[model samples]
Target: TILSSDAYQRSWKPNETNQQDERNFSRMVVRRLPAEVVADAITQATASNTRVTAMTSSPTDRTIGPDILAKNNKKLTSLNYTLSVFGKPDRTENCDCERSNAPTLLQAVFTRNDPSLISMINGSDRRAKGWIAEVQEWYSGKTKPTNQANGNKRLKQLNDQRKKLLAKAPKKPRNTRDAKATQRYQLTIKKHREAVQVLNRNISKLKGGRSNGNLVKRQITALETDKLINETFLRTVSRMPSANELNMARADINSNQDKIGGVKDLLWTLLNTKEFLVNH
Candidate 1:
């Protein structure tokens, strides 16, 4: 397995004697990730929820459920369309060599200003909620009230339904005749009550209004500058910034009055950096 192989476990630092030996696996030099991998990484890291598969395949490609697949087609359904610019494979050839890994000017341009990437970071048009929004929600101990309210309302409706189901069930000793139905009713009602309790607890935490413990309350307080910088580094580069990098990040953010915007700029800058974009 590659996971247990010497090559895969090799140190990243290049040894002077083997520096020129590309085939010998002397060191783990930086390498560009495959286009599809890059797209998947961005989707995961940013919680962009990008759809990767085409909603509609040609009838020739669809061996089953052709009519259903045809009806479900959508314009913006696949990430492959966007990834082609980065040299995603067309699968015309059987070899993996067909997928391009070489750097391109177009990829650089796309990383900097592509609307698809920007929308992922910022959020979709209908919903202005993405990584930044997620961080804000965490630090503020709140999400859009509308969403929370809707969730609570829906949960209540479901709980009410559960209650009705329970009422329709046979009662007590007589209910024992149908053991499975009585057991299911009792279990479901128990589950509904527990779920309602959890939702109410979460809502309380979101309001920053009297958590059962002080720890949760402290977590919901307004985000600190240093914490935001740390979060950006951890999310984009998968590590904490060095002292110098942290200072530089602070200086850039402190320069602006809009701290959230500063954090946004910092995140964007990090995501564009080679360290975040390539594997070393």
Candidate 2:
């Protein structure tokens, strides 16, 4: 539905009644840029400043205006251009696509332990501790026990409540008074049934989370299972590289091996690339 709406807006034309349609359409997609994008932009700005300073000391830096910078550093220039164009706009237009929901901050905090995926910054421990405490408090306040025994007890209680409600319902709704009472009883019965279903689903999820091993061993098993599934899916869906592409990749690897100072530098470069940095 969102994609369809976006397509409609793209092809929509303005008439006298919809003279401000373009302005209204522009408000449809409000999304926060990815965290990796923000980080990359910061890095690029710092690098650009350093280059500008170094170049200013020489004679060639004076020629690099906005247009010249755009030609040489297209990615950086485009980023700047986009920011300039969309920095702040009118928000009066009512659009369905208001904002892009990103992963919660707590989810990001939990990701610090995965070194291969993300490297945690300094003071991450303090932040993670605060986030964990907040999450624990919230969970305690909101969630009930989802273990098997508790789930069964809750379901039984709900079923008893439903039966009691159903028994109170008028068998023959001959008048408006009987109909109203029967409707109320039916509503109460429906609520109890829904609660029972929710409890059953929660119990299933709790059992799935538990495993027959110590915490560390269970984690290792989960990681291995996840890796196997990912590899299998990639192999099934991804096409093999062409011979020319393979040769080019090998040549690029050899060049990097020769040029890079050490494994650390090579790994850093690989990890900082857009492909590796972005969360899929």
Candidate 3:
């Protein structure tokens, strides 16, 4: 019920009016996100396919077999360095206060000068084609990313998985000694149910439908310059750019000799901005 409230579901926005209405929650303040989120953003910005695997147990838990430990280590290595820079919590504290979201000098330096970030931007480490490549293809009208069929197929798979997880959930402990195991089983099921909720939200967005407006079409020729700029802004900052901002970006691209390079620089600038770096 709490999740259905306006405060919980409200979309965030920057404080554009500069009005001080703190008592009424008139606007949201921009905030530095947690380390895990920042790391995920870097991966998303680079278009890397690597995901942070859910760990079932502590990495240092000696009860786990060597094989499981090695697998966990391999998955951890992918984001460990980036997360460390933003101060990933060690999880030693009992309270959520252990994770710090304070802005730090190190974070700024890393965003500006990290070689790994540049390499990721360049599509190094066998990662999937980066966002720069995708945007370039988009500008050329070579791709149309929407497909309702695919969304429907994925929704079906998620529903099946949810059913299977429910079937496996333990109704009760096998014995008094197994009570802890039953509790853990129910927790895992709950986690999977939450994932279903997320997938449903995404499916709803897809179902909202696409139309051929004046600026862009849903079919092949979605390559209008205005469309590309708006798409970039939406993907990077979760909103469309204002007229002044859009005109400035369009002018920059038009004046630049190297079109691709200009686009790359534009995306890099956005990635480093406070809007992309935090939640508001």
Among all candidates shown, the one with the greatest TM-score: 1
173-245 in candidate 1: lDDT tens per residue? 4656898887877887677677666656665555554233322322321348888888778767889999999
Clashes of each: 0, 0, 0
Put down candidate 3 lDDT per residue, 28-115, tens digits, no spaces. 7656887777766666555622211222232332121123433554322255567777877777998777777778898888888777
List the pairs of residues colliding in candidate 2.
none
Candidate 2, residue 57: lDDT = 88
Candidate with the greatest lDDT versus the true structure: 1
* Candidate 1 to truth, TM: 0.57
Q: For residues 1-280, could you state the per-residue lDDT of candidate 2 as single tens digits?
A: 8877855656344456566544666333334445435433322222322343554486553321234554564232323322222222223557624333344443243333333122211112111222222222333333233464575565566566656655664443456578777797677767766766665676566556554323221221333333323322222223344557445434443455321122122233333343333433
Alpha carbon lDDT of each predicted model:
0.64, 0.38, 0.62
RMSD of each: 11.6, 22.3, 20.0
Which model is ahead, 2 or 3, in terms of lDDT?
3
* Candidate 2 or 1, higher lDDT: 1
- Candidate 2: minimum summed lDDT over ten consecutive residues — where? 120-129
